[model samples]
Target: MVQQRSVTYVNNTTPLSITTKELDLENCVNDNQVAIKIHSAALNPVDSVISHAANKWLVGSSLKTVGMDYAGVLVKRGKNVDPKFQIGDKVNGFISHAFGDQGSYSDYLIIDPSKQSAIGHMNNFDYLDDDVKARFSDFDINASYPLVFGTAYDGLFSNGQLLNSRSRILVNGASTAVSQCLIQIAKKHLNVETVVGICNSKSFEYNKKAGFDHLIAYDESNCLEKVQSIIKDKFNGQKFDLIFDSVGTSEFFPIIDTILKPRAEGSLYTTVAGSNKLKYTGGLKEYVSVLPLWNYAASWNPRRHYNYTYTMVWPKPAIMELASLMVSKKQFIPPLDSVYPFEEFQTAMDKLNTNQAKGKIILEINKDY
Candidate 1:
């Protein structure tokens, strides 16, 4: 048994312990998977939850691994794989749910090329090799879309029910990784007349600079009431067309209901820590709908079948292509708060636990490709 150093839970209650572990490469579905020389990995709350609550909801089968989003270089490709990706190509993408095959924290990480959502598309062909350049660019085109774009991209267009020229939107947690992109895309792509951001008063300056029409700090006395007071007439004399919530705390919901017109469509997208909870009232439970944003991203068209309305959230190829263009154009900046050296991974996790960081935390892997 070959051992690889990895961070794993000693038990559900304990903090992750770093230890030498067997490389269960054989557990992967196929042999053609390529190993990524991980240069960096982003720390998400999901990782911590899985470490502690491994049994409650996140069942660890053969599929338990640390890290989800990674930026790295292709070190080696397995057999039967196309020769498009040679060694040393810069890449970034998400690791799938199958943990044994998708772990990205190890020195060498493996991924199926066919399954990657975002990868760097490099053009390193000689001028003479036009056909080769085109072919390589086409085949190895790891579309360089950032992970931060995922929640915003999916939430806005899919769940938020946005079209190119829809009504203005108010994003509650505008400084979040997801909310930043939401503002960018709404400002750039959509003809939004207004983009109000409700967040900490300290973040008011930043959100104002980022193009928010109004920046209200929720902690301020009667902040929600203030919003209502200011926008009451515009909202309908009593309503708004849409309200996007990245903060799902119970407190935010009444404000959401207040802002929305009685029959108007509104969506609330939450990227905050922890799972979503549905609230119900007496005898009205049947009509209430509580949804996860991912569900809309996967299945654009909600369908009613066999006693339930099911919508599958998916990464559409077209939306990803749009994200690629947005990246190359630099229309939006992804929120990368801080990068931690591999040895200081625990420290990075600590910072994220504070929830005070403005953006995403990244862990840089030590090895050079």
Candidate 2:
């Protein structure tokens, strides 16, 4: 057993508490434990969201760790871990297993074998390659991209019922990580008939390069009307087949309702509204599904959409498959705003909390990694 330094939230709100403790390297049963020599980790808005509101959900528990994504080399493994992964293999994963202690805000962390995303095949140490080692060095950034993509991909293809060469696709908050993934996947991979991105006018050009064939600025008094006019000019008065709204504010819904094609076979995917609130309106068939990243089993919002919500649990098998595919196609790229050494963890958290970083923030734990 080795002692691992970790970050924890002692109180329900504000200010953080970082500390260290002993973590067992063994004693893993049924493959419920994994020891990671954390090389790097990323911060998501959910951290702040949970920290501020988790007080209500508390059962008088004092321990709370806030982190969802981590990437590193496997230092130790519990028996029954996917048999294909071994010590020293590079991996990246999202932690959605039962919530508290399993979070990734630590020097070393454990992920139940069921929640890991395997990036490479394991081999006897002697047979590993320079490229694989080099690849592992960037796991932090590499792993973050998948979480964004998995959310967008699963939401679109599965929940939204989007298919290849379908009608126009509208993506609100197009410049976001999830939207970026949607743009690329919808345009370059799926080849939708039209890909439109809606955002502030200032970011229109940026959204264009990210994959939106058409960019709409929703800042005007008649922004919805403007969007409708643009679609008419472009698609000969056609309606959108799918709409993905990453920003869930109330304003977005009216815009979606106004521009969404009436009675068209399509859906509106929103990350802001949790799957529990998945709803429909105006005789428009909108499929709403939540982003389930914990269990592999697909559950539903139990709403009208009846969306088969499957958890994108970073299971080793799915992770390896997606990673290998991305590597083969050269798509495992992380959009990094900056990287901070492990010692600057507080600084990193501050930047993230302020919403100052435009892209993912990476924290390097080990100097050599």
Candidate 3:
């Protein structure tokens, strides 16, 4: 039996606490599954978030691999595996499931597309078999898109309700990878008229390259006041169609009534930021002060005027295909921040945990690739 080195952890630990191990590559999977030799993989913020949760609500042993996005060549397949996915086919995407043992940090991975691919969101939604298959000569770059871009696409459409080309949007944490994708998709695909992005002062030009029409420096004082001023001046007191919080801050949410259109007006305030705004500047203080999770039941109130929801990425075939098509047409660009060798994963995680990376941080699993 062959053996491979993989990153492993017991959870509830800091990113630097993660360790490595060797596993015998024996009968990795069966039935509608394929084994892949990963060439590249991408790191994400949620990687540490889930790890710190220590398998809460997820069943896993003390040991599990770590990673989500990966790009590789198929090496083996189960008997019932789809004929369309043959050995040697190059593919890349992400695994988003309730389990952690099946991570992509290793040189080898076994995935059951029907369940772990996040396609159709664990088959909860409809997805195509080939939706996750997109290859590029640069595996590091390919490894970056599936998670962030997919999240952006889902955040925009899954709950976006009835947005169209004329829609206007406000994106917090505009420099975030997912936010950048959101700006681009809303502008180029949906043809949104005006898209405003909030980032640090230094990233104005950088965020603009991601298709943000207007950029604001959140680092400045009275940021929300400026946001309100824009609403009053730019649209003549018109509310924004969408207020997306990518940095996890609820700072814009409480004042959303002034910044967003009402439910009656078909407007929404959606955040990917979870409970805390996770400003990162305040560290634990920020995490503890994260916003209260929005409840759907709140919408039951007859007097309710605002539509608000929190969403995470759910893999959908249509969205994945659209992204893939856009990539092929060069209509979508996934920003790349830096690459780390497999051995330097801890350093990579350090950067990611800072929430300071301008784009995706990739791990070149197969350095030769």
Candidate 1, residue 327: how far the Cα is off, in Å: 2.3
Q: Evaluate residue 61 in candidate 1 and report its C-alpha lDDT on the 0 to 100 scale.
A: 40
In model 1, the runs with Cα more than 4 Å from the true position are 1-4, 21-32, 56-63, 79-84, 98-101, 116-145, 233-239, 255-257, 261-320, 367-369
Q: Each model's TM-score?
A: 0.72, 0.78, 0.87
Query: What lDDT score belongs to each candidate, Candidate 1 first?
Result: 0.56, 0.59, 0.73
**lDDT (10s digit) by residue, model 2, range 104-162:** 66777666666455334321222224554454445555545555656666656655475
> Which residue runs of candidate 3 sit more than 4 Å off their true CA positions?
13-26, 55-61, 118-137, 279-291, 294-297, 300-302
Most accurate candidate by TM-score = 3
Return whichever of 2 and 3 wins on lDDT.
3
Model 2 is weakest, by summed lDDT over 10 consecutive residues, at 279-288
Report RMSD (Å) for each prediction in the order shown: 8.8, 7.5, 5.7
Candidate 2: Cα lDDT at 293: 36
**Candidate 1 local distance difference test against the native:** 0.56
